[model samples]
Target: MKLLYTTLLVVVYIIPAINAAQCLSGQYPPKPERLLPTYVVNLDAPPVERWQDLASKYKVELKDLIAYLKTFLVEISPELQYLVDLVDTKLPAMADTLPAPYGDEMKGISQASGLPLGEVVLYNIFYEVSSLCTSIVGQDEKGNIFHGRNLDFGGLMGWDKINHTWALTEKLRPLMVQINYTKNGQVLFKTTTFLGYIGSLTGVKPGVFSVTINERNIVKGGYIGLIEWMYNINRNQSFITFAIRDMLTNSESYNQTVKYLAEVPLVAPCFYIVAGTKPGEGAIITRSRKGSDDVKLLGRDDLWFLAQTNYDNWKKQPFFDDRLTPCIKCMQEKGKNQVTFESLYNVLSSRPMFNKETVYTSIMEPATGRIEAYWQLCLDEEAPCRPW
Candidate 1:
């Protein structure tokens, strides 16, 4: 542990300086030779067995992911072990009680992966508390809306846990999956997420809208409150990420989707950015537990874009969410005229926006149902400080 702390200090301080000029220099790792395959989850299958197909196909990768998640459980166990351990056992039952298919899907993932249900449950909930992301929505000259984001997640301490060979983010790169949820014969919605998790932090309802979740800044008991809510599971309770998925599956129009997202009850606070297919269909919904704390939309006449980076849109100079200002500045420079898939991808992949913690970048267009999900890495050319 002492050695680990020392290494972390070196990573946080010394390495950033070594790579100061290169960090977020619009340099990205050579795109992976192949993207992870989309898992087609059939709703017709019993929820308990829905993930069996994925398990059969990606058994080895799933085992590797389980091993990776255990390191985090072990690392953070000192302070939260009692709670984590207790809830670990109750996860399967919690799944049974929650109205969503999460519990059953997790059970299916565990059963198919040949792993403990408790660990799988913990893995599903882990990122909800820790992920830091950037989401941007814009309208182009043609009136098509574009939505893009980078999903960044990793506990700084446990990042180098993979035999110290790769960061947890790197290990997660290959595990990225774009899940297409199929009902009877057609695709309902799609989420760019990890393989085992059933929730959607980044998803799109084709030709309708796209939505992304950025962890909200908490003044007080946000993380613990969410865990407590999960511990005492109720059918009445719904997680925001689960709510995002539900919205994608059910909501038909952009306006209807906005209303549902802004009004849904959540166990925690978060920022939901939605982009529609029309000219002025974009919004950033800053949410409290019960409903929206604030809803900022586009089309303040020439207001062509909105960028969110884990802070309430109303705050000035968010203390920890440093990415917000830079994000806005970059988008403004790109301008509304350049708001295409490729240009937005450029904005998201640039430095500051594209930092070491980013695991994957997602670009979506609801107009034509175009979704581009890619695993990300910062090469030494981009970030010498990249611990992975």
Candidate 2:
């Protein structure tokens, strides 16, 4: 009797272990009813309504729409035939690849669009569907186990995974855009120079050199400034004329390109001077224009002038002393240049000292002429000084 009781207990334990393993491996007796809530949603709706909507909304032909949607659904949930049918009827044809649950089907769309396979995947998952899922999940009930709407268990997994993936990719977009713009600008520059060479060889005056600028091709902000500078310096008036024409026609590059004007050597120097100061620094200088005004100065020691004449001598040294001395001498020669003093003071006070290794870049067309020194004051550590 004792032996038989021991045997029965061992059998009970073994049976449960086997069943647990089977459940984990999904080899257990089918429990279709226990599947997630997505299993219950009707994937099949009226085919005519679905096809018409897909055509109208997504602008995909009915047949292609049906095909892609079918593939997309199958990738997300193979067993959920009803859900697939529902998607076919309810959703528009996916013109773009979707991330995660539907990512497997992206291969086909990537090929169709002629975009890199990686980029197509990124656009679909990170840029498009990730935003869509975040919007959906935010609206979902806090306790809802079924986190995603219009998605099956597999699709939900994809959405969850894709969100994590996008967090990383989104951070890299700006950096990628910077690199791409730099590379493209270099290529375009070389191509323009080559064409100029070809024209020279044929004994033909290089016709008006034209540059097409579009947001898609150009980098935003500072890099755009850099490109404009390069174009102006290399191509001269013909390039400027072309740029002006584009500007008048309201080209996308106009706002950035047209702001630059040729004013001889003074333009480049003035831009260098202005560019050296931070944006708000100039405003601060303007506000502190009067000598009687009290101003709070932030102690930043990064100010330096580009030493144009003695490059070899000044190459290793900061141009702070040489730059400031001229302004100081000028201040003495003609009662303190108050505006120049305030501008320099505000800049020194407000901006942090940038590292010596940091690169400063700007673009300005040089034209000939000089302007009077507006204001100058000697920077004394304790007080602003001027020779009477």
Candidate 3:
């Protein structure tokens, strides 16, 4: 009788454990229509010649895409047009806030892609200008910082979900570029970006840090607050991803990266996940559009593993609430093992939290200068969905 009773208790505990573990192996999503294109560009050369080279390589695609975006602007044309006009009047002052290299790069993009300077400016702030995404940061068993996300947005122009559909292979793939910037006297940085944009929406500079950004849900303040946000456009502050780009240029450690991200003034409310090369260094930072003083960080001290699925840490916004518990359980179990690059990949692959809208996925081991990424949402079709 005693033996049977003990057996029953063990079974009860083990069954739930098995069920939780199974969530990591959830159903594989169907393949995306096309794989995202990846390429490299060197901006170390003279700005005119360099951008002109890019223009020459992808001129046709860039031209068409710009037209597509302009069409989307038609839907919210009045508001966006007013904002663009505001930016145009303040262009010089706004450009001054960016590091000098960005100005050169933007000019190169504009010149090379045949995009107007004003259009180039709008493209640089795409994330803030566009709708949504989700970012997560966690440390592997080896303690390397890794961040993953699903970048969701209304399809470019009016292709209607075209970003995820394979049908966009020819048109969209050509515009996907992985820029490698290595000026003679500057830090080397690599970014996975669309052609003709000069910001780091997602990228890494090995030995510095791997970083990504997401937007905060606008606050539910009174009408007075909304009016104030509209009137208080500070073009002089660094836009979100551009701020991450600036940090990669100067910061050398995880702490320094966090500090820079915390102190920088930004044009919109944003979240940043920065994983450092050192153990216990990665962090998720939440800040109000109001700026630095509103900065709050959730780091290893708070939780050894953290994931941001388009929700602020404070309010625990519930977009993917169902996936959270299972993901947290899976990551914790994996952390107990010899966490390899594959381990990090598994966490993102896990269906409970791996968003269907994921357009790109990246895994980084900054300490060893190793990084791997798969884009265009095709990782599902691969037999063994491990890092490439």
User: Model 3 segments beyond 4 Å from truth?
Assistant: 1-43, 74-78, 81-99, 155-173, 185-187, 220-235, 292-302, 319-326, 333-335, 352-356, 378-388
Model 1, residue 278: C-alpha shift (Å): 1.0
**Ten-residue stretch with the least lDDT total in model 3:** 379-388
lDDT, each prediction: 0.73, 0.20, 0.56
Which candidate leads in lDDT? 1
Top TM-score prediction, candidate number: 1
Show model 2 residue runs off by greater than 4 Å.
Answer: 1-178, 182-388
Error of 3 at 179 (Å): 2.4
Name the lDDT value of residue 111 in candidate 1: 83
TM-score of 3: 0.73
- Across 140-188, the per-residue lDDT of candidate 2 in tens digits comes to 1121111001100011211113332112222222111000001222211
Model 1, position 206: C-alpha lDDT score? 84
Task: Using TM-score as the measure, name the better of candidate 1 and candidate 3.
Answer: 1
The TM-score values for the models, in the order shown, are 0.87, 0.15, 0.73
Q: What's model 3's overall lDDT?
A: 0.56
lDDT score, candidate 1, position 378: 56
TM-score of 1: 0.87
